[model samples]
Structure formats: structure tokens, C-alpha cells
Target: MSPTATTPPVLTSVQIPCCVCGTMILPNAANQCPTCLAQEFNLTERLQRGPAGQKHIVIHQCRNCRRFARTPTRYEFAEHESPELLSICLKHIPALNQHDLQLVDASWIWTEPHCMRLKVRLTVRTELLSVVVQQRVMVELHVQFQMCPECNRDFTNRTWHALVQVRQVRNDSKKGLAALEMALAKNKTIRQHVLKVDTKKNGFDFYFLSNTHAQTFTNFLQRVAAMRIQRTTKMVSADNHSNTANMKTTFMAQMVPLCRDDLVLIHRKAAGSKLAGSLAIVTKVSSTIQFVGASPKRTHVSDSMMELSADQYYKTEKHYQMLQAGHRLVRFVVLDVELCDEQAPSGQLYEGPHSGVEKYALADVTVARESDFGVNDEMFACVTHLGHWIAAGDVVLGYDLVNSVGTDDWEMQEQLHGGFTLPDVVLVKKAPRNKETAAVGVDEQEGQKRMTKKRERRKRYKEGRKQKELEETAGRMGFFDDINEEQVDEEGEDVDADFEAELANDPELAAELLNLERDLAQLDDGDVVAEGEDNQLVEEDNQDS
Candidate 1:
């Protein structure tokens, strides 16, 4: 026997259930066992259940799944733990997730299973906060209008527009806007009203929630502004005329309305051509009230223009002054306005704080109708006067003012020197008794400002002076001004010693006192002498006997 061939020691085979398959796989097989490789588990279940008794580990289970293919111990779980710990443990699992979580954090994912759809709401409170919403720098804006902001009791406008800059949280997102609206609806201060919502490019978004008299808000003003369509850019000057020191900013717009027939007039002018983009509201003082009628001649322009809503169009000072006039809000049906053929420019009431014509001056308006209107740059037809004093109907195209755009408010008397340029058809109402608005002199405003400033400065100065005087007086009184302290005992002793020294230095008094002392000494001596004399006398008597 050729030395019996040693049999290779057979290795014990340990089978491991494939994580991917339900079948046991041999350790030495080059390929995964087909049965073990085909195993599957419910993913959602893997994220549901947490680790046993571990606070950080939550095993997650699928709603419809129970086990991993045929394996009994395989399932999904979601764990709850701190983000710091999860980062250390889940360092190897490749994953990407947008966590919708409230109290639960990412670290929880490391504890056995971390796959739970979480929804959460958080509320945060802070002290000494930044008050982010209130720090905005804003401008106060005014636009020429034929209606009043107060006519409908704009308490909201007044309280919101006061000098204070308010805090606001604005929602630019669609979902946030709806949520904000719902939240505002619950507020007692907010009234219930439905506003239309439109979402489109070149489309305006208008929605707002207002607080009438609130300020120092953490976040709320932007919600209120959204209700209005005007997202305006505003700039402020120094304190305006009002002592209140409010800044002023103005915008351009046209608020007049137009009729169906006017569209035909515009249509005829374009002669069946594209009419939408060609027409623009001309802001020139002379161009503002000029109208184009169906006949295309000197025709009076009515308040009803194509622009449905009131608009502010910057114009010559005259036009601004005119638009600044007192306006009375009148409601008329669309058809009734057409029947009237013309409407009066709402007269501006420059009263109270606005006692004078603003910086804008009166314009040199011509007298004319639609036919007399002149075209400037072939764009807008210029009409001299529709309702102004000249009463003549004339049309002149594009005329530049002395320095600026012409305003329609008041005409300089000099423009009348050339006589009427257009045929006269309508008469401007004769100057009413108080036609000349009481011109509040500019000096009055300036003087008032000076006086107010002077008075304030004087008050502050007086207060400072009084405080300084009191402080000086108090200082003069020395330490402990109220209660006086006793003089030091040493000082009293010195005073007494000085008084005694002065008494001793008195020459006459000292001499008298010295003589008294000499007498007392002689008395003692007298007694002794008296005794001696008696003895001598007695001896003498003895001798004589």
C-alpha cells in the first residue's frame, strides 16, 4: 500500500440565510445561492418598528407587509435618536431624504430602523428679539384721486399709514397666502370679505389682512398690503408741511372711465387698426382734459376715459393742482356716464392743512373741444381748455411749458393774451364766489415750522437749563446738602481756646484782676502782723508799770 493518501480534513459547512434571499447560502460558493438572492422585504415595515426598550430605536413596520420574504427575523424599523449619534452610527448606509419632522430628529435613523414619515409643527418664543418685521424703511405715497380714501371710513388707512413703521410677515407663496387669509379670517379685528385671486404672468396679485391700530408687530404688515393691488415704490422727503413731520411721495395714474361708444371713437381713429397699445394717458397740463369724440373734432373730454379705475398721472404743476382739488365721490352706472356726455373734473378742496396750491403752479389752459385737440409726437392730442375760464374751444398739439410739463389746475392769465386759438363752443363755469382758493402762503408753512422748531428747542433748552441749575445749586450746598452735620469737636475746642486767649490779652481787665489777687495776699499777712502787734503792745504796758 503506497502510504495511504491522507484524506484532506473536511471543513464543517455553516449556511447563512442570505439577507437578499430566503434560502441558506454556502460560504464557499462563488455565486450567491439563487434562492437566497431572490428574497425581498416590505420597505415601509422596515421603517416602522423601533428597537426593543430603546428610547432612540423605533422599529418601523410596513402597513401591508409582515416579514422579509420567507425569513422570520427580517423586518424594517425606524429609530429615534439625536442627530449627533445617528451621524456616527448611520455613517455607512447610503441614503437621501427630506425629513418632515417635528420633535424627531435625524440621529433617530441610526437606531436599528429610521424610516418614518413624520409631520410636525413647531412654535418658538424669544425675548429681546430683533423684531424683524418692524425695521423696514418705507415711504409715504399720495396719488391724485377723484375719490376720497376716507369716504368709506378708511380707519385702516389712517392707523396703518401713521408715522410708525410696522412689523410684517409677508407671504409670497400661494399656499402661504391662502393660509394667511384663513388665519386673518379668524381675527376679530379683521372683517370678512372675499377678494378675487388671479395667478398669471402680467397678472396682479391682491390680497391682504390689515390691523387697524397695531404696531411693533413681530410680523404682520405685509399681509395687510397684499390686499391692495398697488405694490408701490415710494420715497420720502423731509417732514412735509404738517407739523407731524410726515414724508411725502406721489405717483402717476389716470382714474377716468371710458364708454363703449368711446371705444368706437378710438376704433375709428385707428381705422380698424390695432388700438390697444397705441393710446396712452398724456399727463401734460394741456393734454389731461382734452377729449377725442366720434367726430374727431373739438369735442369735450368727459371724466369717463378708457381707464376704468382712478389713476395718478404726473402732469404740469397745473394738472397736479387740479387733481389735488376737492373731490366728491359720486357713483354712477356705466351707461349713465355715457348719457351725460361730459363730467366736471372733481374740484379739489385745498382747505385745512392743505390751504394753498401745492408746489405746482396754475397752468395756461386753452379753450377747445375734441376737434381742437392737437397731437403731440403723433401720440396724444392736446386740448387747450375743456372747463377752464377761457371758455374758448381750441386744439393745439404738443406745447412745452416754461420749464416743466403743463398742469391743468389753474391757468396763468398771460396765456389768454394771445386770444382763443380754437373755436369757442363751451363756457367754463364763471368763477364761483371763492374761485381763488385761499392761497396758503408758503411763508406761513415755513414760519410755522420755524416757530414749532423754535418752541420745541426752547422747551428742551429750558428743561436742560432747569436741570443744570438745580444740579449747580445742589453742588454748591456741599456734601449732604439736606441734613447739616455737627462741627468737629476739635474745632470747637480750638474756638474755645482762642476765646480764652483773647480774654487773657485784655490789658485793663487783666490789671484789675491782678490787683484783686494782691489784696487777698495782704489779708493773710495782716492777720500775722495783728498778732505780733498785740504782743508788743502788751510788753510795753508791762514796762510802763
Candidate 2:
């Protein structure tokens, strides 16, 4: 029957003759065409991903013994049209993105009655261009939370999830990377799913996207260059850093905080699951805690919500921010700090009061700062913050202090947690000896000398401030006082401000004035030294004569 003119053309299956067998067969095989069953070319549509945003490409394969073996086709003694031709060749293929193709389908063609032919097409779903630009890289953050010192036994119930914008995505080998980057500058959080990542690829360099179009990738590159620094530095004693011990498995991801609570359910292999112990809520978050306290020592555990929600007594305090869509999580709990005393000099460490009652102090307050790392004197400059100077060898309360590193960095971290910076007195030890040393006497005389020098430095600081003020006034008034006319002062003037103003205008005389000032200062210093030398020499000559 004749079809209507408006009807769409249907794609019918193609059939071919078996070149060698000279037999008729179905047009389609499992993944190949029947005629080419003996010799078929297979093009596979694999779901394997490359770098997430790089439009996925479908691999083409020729059907033969080797290529056909890979497919689940029933055709066994298949002969190929071209045995010598590479089955999986990148050529003889069309360039298409992941979404351009359809699902795995087979067809066939032939030449002589002796041979058959097979063709396979792989398919892919369409993708939204705007959505891909929305998110390119996922940003996951984890923080340990805590409550105010006044709050007793408090804990963060859950981690605060933020879809921080990772500015790397807008690039993705595109022509409009700059335009895309400029658009995303105002927005930070991105939808987690929007940023597709290929875990197989070690790194992703895509900037996150937001509602206000995507930002230019160039801007994100600039931001990454500025603020990133080593978040944590692990330093061992001078002797241990190089040769420190190694273990079987080093880094690991532990369970989230909720695992600590007894409210969690534990399942058995045979019987049904039951409600177990509670996690230790060492830290606080108004109502919910990161973990429930189950034991004396704090450990971590995490199971899927589907598995644990079966026994549902625990509270879920979802804040307004939690409603936003995101798959990333950041979990942590700030702990109640305590001072502990132990047996060794480096003993009595400040362990956490995690579940019930435990103690932990700045490593300094309890034991010593392990000095085996590369903490040398030249690398760190020691300056007294509040008129206190700590010596190298004095074991103040018992902890070891590094050369001039007055206190531990962790000690000051407490200040960020609503605590204040540590005082000079917090230094537990004089720090002259290692964990093996006995109480050695400190030189009382040296301590007194240190106090004397502090007074001198204070006096010097006062003089320096006064000098700076006078020089500022001299420059602003456009007049020079002899006291403020020291050669050093002139050289120290803001060159950028005066250089062009003076030199640009009086380019000729500026050089002379500078030279004359420098010469005068040199002569004055020389004359003073010569006069002293002459006096000493004259006295010596006279005494000899």
C-alpha cells in the first residue's frame, strides 16, 4: 500500500548474504548482523567516562573472531570481511559526542553469497549545555565543630553542607572560558550533580557555576593562585622526620559523627538489626551532635541512612540551610578542652573529654612540643608579643619549647574557638632537654640578662617611633630639620611619591643633592672614628717614647 506523503520514513533493518556459507540468516545477531556472523564489525557503546566534561566518544570495533568474541553473540565460526583490518580502529567512524548516538543496535550488509556483514550503533542520551556549565567541580568540606566552653556536654548534630564554588569548571577546553568565568564571579555554591567528575581522571579543573550565568575561568585561576597554602604541616623531631616509621595502610576515611551515639542501630548478619549503644557527643551543636557517645574512647562509624533510620528515636534537627539541594557533606565537632596530668615529663597529655570525662591540653600544657621536625632558629624569627621572652633551655612547666617558638601553634588555635591567645606562662617547660632529661638547673644569671635586654629593646622601639613621626612631618612641611636630615632618612622616604615629583621635574639637581647628603654622612662617621683612632695612637706613641 502507498503511504501518505506526510508520514515519516521508517528505518528498516538491512540484510546481506553470507559470503562464504552461501546461506540466508536474520539481519541481526546479538550485537552483529546474521550474514556477517562469520565476519562482523562491532561498534560498542560503552558507558566508561573520560574527564567528565570532555564530550564522551563512542569506540568503534570491527567484527571478527577477536572483536566478536568480546560480544555475547551466538555466532561461533564467524569469518570476517577483512581479517587483516584492525577490528577496533578509530578511523571509519563519525565524530560524535556522547549524546549523539542511540542505544546498542545491530544491522547488516553483504557483497557476494559467500559473505555476510554486520553493523552496530551505540546510543547516548542528550545533555543540556546550560546544566553542564552550572557545575564543573565538586567542593566537599569537613570541619570539626564545638560549643562554647560554658556549654557542658554539647555536640554538633550534623555537618554543615555548603556547595562552595570550585572555579575550575568553566574552562573545559572551550572557546568561551573567559566569558563563562566572568559570569560565575558573583555565585559560589553550585549543585553537586551539575559538576560531573570522572573519578578515573585524577584531577578536574572546572570552575563551579551559579544562577548568574557562569563566570570566566580566568578569574577562578587567579583566585586559586592566591589563598591556597598547606593546611596542615606534619613535623617530627630532628631525628625522626626522615626515618619515621611506616605502616601498612596510612590515610583513611572514618565514619561521620552520628556513629558515636547509642541512638545508632547495628544490624546482624542472620537475625534482624537491633538498637545498640549511643555515640559520644563530645562536642555540641545546640541539639544534635556529630556523634553519639558509646564508649570511653572516641571512635567513628557511619552507615547509610536507610540502614540506620530503621530504629528512629534520634532527632534530626534540620536547619534552613539543609533544605538546599546538595550531595556533599562536611562533618565535625569542637571538643570540651581540659588540662590533664600524666606520669612522664611529656606525660599527662590533654586527651579529649570526648564521650564522658576525658582531658586534653595544648601539647605544650601537658608534655613537650616534639622538636624532631625541621624547626631551626633561622627559619622562625622570635619576637615577644607582650614583653615576654622565653629561653631555649628552660623547662617552664615541663613541655619542650623550640628555639624562639615561644608557644605551640595549637595553643593559639584555641583562641579561634572563642578562646584567647596563650600567655607566655602557658609554656610548660624551659625546653632544654628531650623526653629523657632530668631536671637541670637554669642559669639564673641568664634569665636576668634577658630581662635587661627587653628593657633596651623597648627603649629602642620608642626612639624609632619618634624618629619616624619627625621624618613624616619634615616631608609634609616641605622643610628639612638637621635632626631629621640624616642620610638614612632621605633614602627611606617614599621613593614612589617623591621620585617622579622631584626627579621628573628637577631630574638634574636630584642626583647632586642625593650625592652631597650621602658624602656628608660618610665624612661625619669617618671623622668621629679617625678622631678616636688618632687619640689612641697618640697616647700609645707618647707612652712608648
Candidate 3:
């Protein structure tokens, strides 16, 4: 078939006069020139009469926490170029909700951060008289420093609606308290509710904004450690007309007196006929206390350890006495270890509650006091459950019952139990190496250098106390500014060498501490940026038109 002949259509231009200026323009729906239409629909003038009817929009910002408030009811933590900040800016422009007007694009504008000004450029489109009009409008946000209600209450010493007083029954050893602190710091769900954490002489005092938070924290503590809680409430204020009263609740959590490696003399009646011996050493401390008999005669029965619940321990706490506290444990060097025969079935294994997947083998270990290693030839032999971890030449902490002073109750118990005799030494866990000493050799100059470095770290830690408090306060208020990864790496490297050494032995604990450290570093970096420094205005060039 022959293709139809085609001819090019001629393009025609029709001129039209501007409605206001009477200027000739291309034929279009508006029937007006570009200049007259632009003058009639002045974006800047229309924006002046829009929802935000001023050239400068005042944004209330908390001076202490650095959070912004767009309205009186709510405060938010928004970062530059973030969707949250964009939404906050758009909320001020109510004209965008009109049927004809539509939001085309929005973006942030860079300005001097120190000037406390934020600028946003918004592109909007609208239909008028069968014509489409698009315009870009600039909005200036003036930040006003104001203390929020929370900060004001904090400054007035009324920050907490509930107080948790955490105390340990035995204050001589801080091991239990340290573990409790770690537990509190690692749990993000619980830490978010904590307003302030104060270190007391015996333990820590946690403050919460609400009584429910305090109760949640107390329950968390019970799950992590062996502790008993007592609750009380006091009326803070009362309104007779409304029949309303504001009450502040207080929770007193007392941790168990016994800690890991503690040597205890249990009363025969308190033992409840389940325990074979009165003398035992604490093997683990969690929601419940686990103890293994330390008497030489009961070495065969050590595998079947006794468990003491928190409630039972508290009920009979007066009947039990600590013979040797963990803090007074003596250092011992392992001279030899002989693994005992496995008595369990071929497929069966004995695992303690806190052991997790670890498998322990009983062994007879010969140890000598580290102090008397070369000075004297005295040695002691004992049975320990750490056969999988302990080896010759390893240093460990143990109770030296030979030289330990016994209480009157302990002496009487010993006299009554003629058949049972306490072992000369009871070994606990392996000792954590001293990083300060291990890093430097025996050279005096190296030791001096290490000391100087330790002193410097201490000085830096002390100097940053005020700044840390501010950062911690901001963190509790759910405000975390943007942070650089490099800053985080640097902060992570400065961890205490001793703490690092201790954490090396417990991978799970180390992981928890790592999370805690990362969170703290982010808080620290945010505070550093907020304190008299230029705000980080992220420049984002990607915008839809």
C-alpha cells in the first residue's frame, strides 16, 4: 500500500496583553504577562499573610537539653536536613493545606550556625484562573533559648517523681555494687527512664521521672541480681477542692550480703538438712546464691551445690555469718592442678545456673600465697570447680582461712563440728591481670611513664565531670545530637585499662559494656557540639522541583 503524503503543520504565535500592565505576552490561560502575574502573586507578600504571619518565626529551644519546640505542647530533637525537622517546618505553614495550593519540594538552607538561625526553602504550586503557578519561598527560623519545664524542675531539685535507694547489706565489698551498676547501664529500656544516677557511699541512688519507671527499674534489678525491694509513698501535695494528691514513691532495694567467693558459716538450722556442711564458699551470685561446700570432708559432694533464694536468705540472714569477705581475699599462685574423675553419666554434665554453656571439671589445686612464694615454702591444697580455666602459673584469688580471724559464732560452730574441718585455702576465680603493670616492663622508667599516663587519664576524667553531667542529663531527656564516627573511635580507645582487662575474661559482660560505652560516647559528642560550638548544618543538595 502506498504511504499517505504528509505535510508539516505551520506553528502560529498569538500575542496577548497583560491584564494589569497591558503588556503583550504569549497566549496562555492567565491572559497576562509574566511580570504582571508575578507582581499579582507575590510569593513573599503572600507568605507574610500565611499561617506564619511574620518574617521571623521564633523557635523555642531548651538551653540545657538543646531540643526544639514548634508548639507549646510538645518538644522534639530534630537534626539538620532530617525529615523530622522538615515536618516541623511544614507544620507552621497552614496555607499549604488549601485545595488549590500544593507543596512541590522543600529543603534546608545553610546559614551561620552561631547566628541561631535556620532557613528553609519551600517550593509550592497552585492553580489560579486555569493557570499553574510555582514559586519558591524562604522561611527564617529564629531560635530562642528557653529552659524547658524538665530542666527547670531539675535545677529546682524536683526532677524525680520517684527515688530508688539501692544499698547492699554488706558494704565492705563493692563487687556486688559494681555488677548492679553494670546491669543498670547496659539495659537501654531501663536506662532511658533514669533521670539521674548518684553514687553513694554504699551503693547508687537512681532517680526517675515517674513511679512506674522506678518500679520497672526495681523489677529489672530483681531479674539481674539478688535483691529485695521495699516501697513507700509520701504525699507531695494535696488539693482539697479537687480531692487530688500528688505522691512521690520511694523504693529501697537491698542487695544480698553474700558475693562471689565469699566464705560463709551457715547455721545448721538455716541449712535445712539439705546442705552437708556448715562452711561453704559462694560460687556464683545472681537472682539466687550458689554455694559449694568448702570443708575437706565434703569434696565429693561439692558438685551438688546448694542454692539460696533471696527470700530465704533474707529471712535467715541473722543466722548466717560471713567468715571472710571477698574484698579481703588473698592472692595465690597455682603450683599444680590435678583433675578429679567425672562421676556423672557419660552424656550428663553438671552445670551451675550462671555457667551458661561452660562445662566445669573438679580438680585439686596446690596453691601458695603470692607474697610467700619466694619468702617461704608454705603451700596449701584445695579443691576448686574452675578446672577448665585454671592452670599452673596462673594467679588466683582465694580465702586464706588459716590466718583469717573468725567471729565468735564461727569459732563456736567450729568447736561444735569436730568431725568437719575447714580447708586451709578456698580458691575462687582467676585473678585479672593488672594492665598498668603488664603494659610496662620491670624498668623503672617505664613504670614512671605508666604512672604519669594513669595520672593524666584521671585528671582528664575529673576535668570532664561537669560536661559529662550535662551530656548525661541530655541523654536522659531523649536528646542525642549527631556524632562523628571518628570521635566515637577515639573515645572508645580511652577506656580504663584495668576495666578492659577485667572485661577480657567475660565476653558477655564486655559486649554489654561496649554497648554502654558507645551510647555514652554518642551523648558526649552531642554535648560537645551543643556547648558554645557551631551547630552542624548538614547541606543536602537533593531536592525535587
For each candidate, what is the lDDT?
0.27, 0.27, 0.68
Clashes of 2: 93
**How well is each residue in 238-285 modelled by candidate 2, as lDDT tens digits?**
456587632221111111223111122121221322212211221212
Candidate 3 has an lDDT of 0.68
**Candidate 3's residue-wise lDDT over 429-456, tens digit each?**
6766663332211223543565577667
Write model 1 residue lDDT over 376-476, tens digit each, in one string.
22122223222232222222112122112232213422222233222111111122222132111122244456446545654656555444433322222
Deviation (Å) of 281 in candidate 3: 2.0
RMSD of 2: 31.6
Candidates arranged by TM-score, highest first: 3, 1, 2
Per-candidate TM equals 0.19, 0.15, 0.55
Q: Is candidate 1 or candidate 3 better by TM-score?
A: 3
The model with the greatest lDDT is 3
Candidate 1 residue-wise lDDT at 51: 36
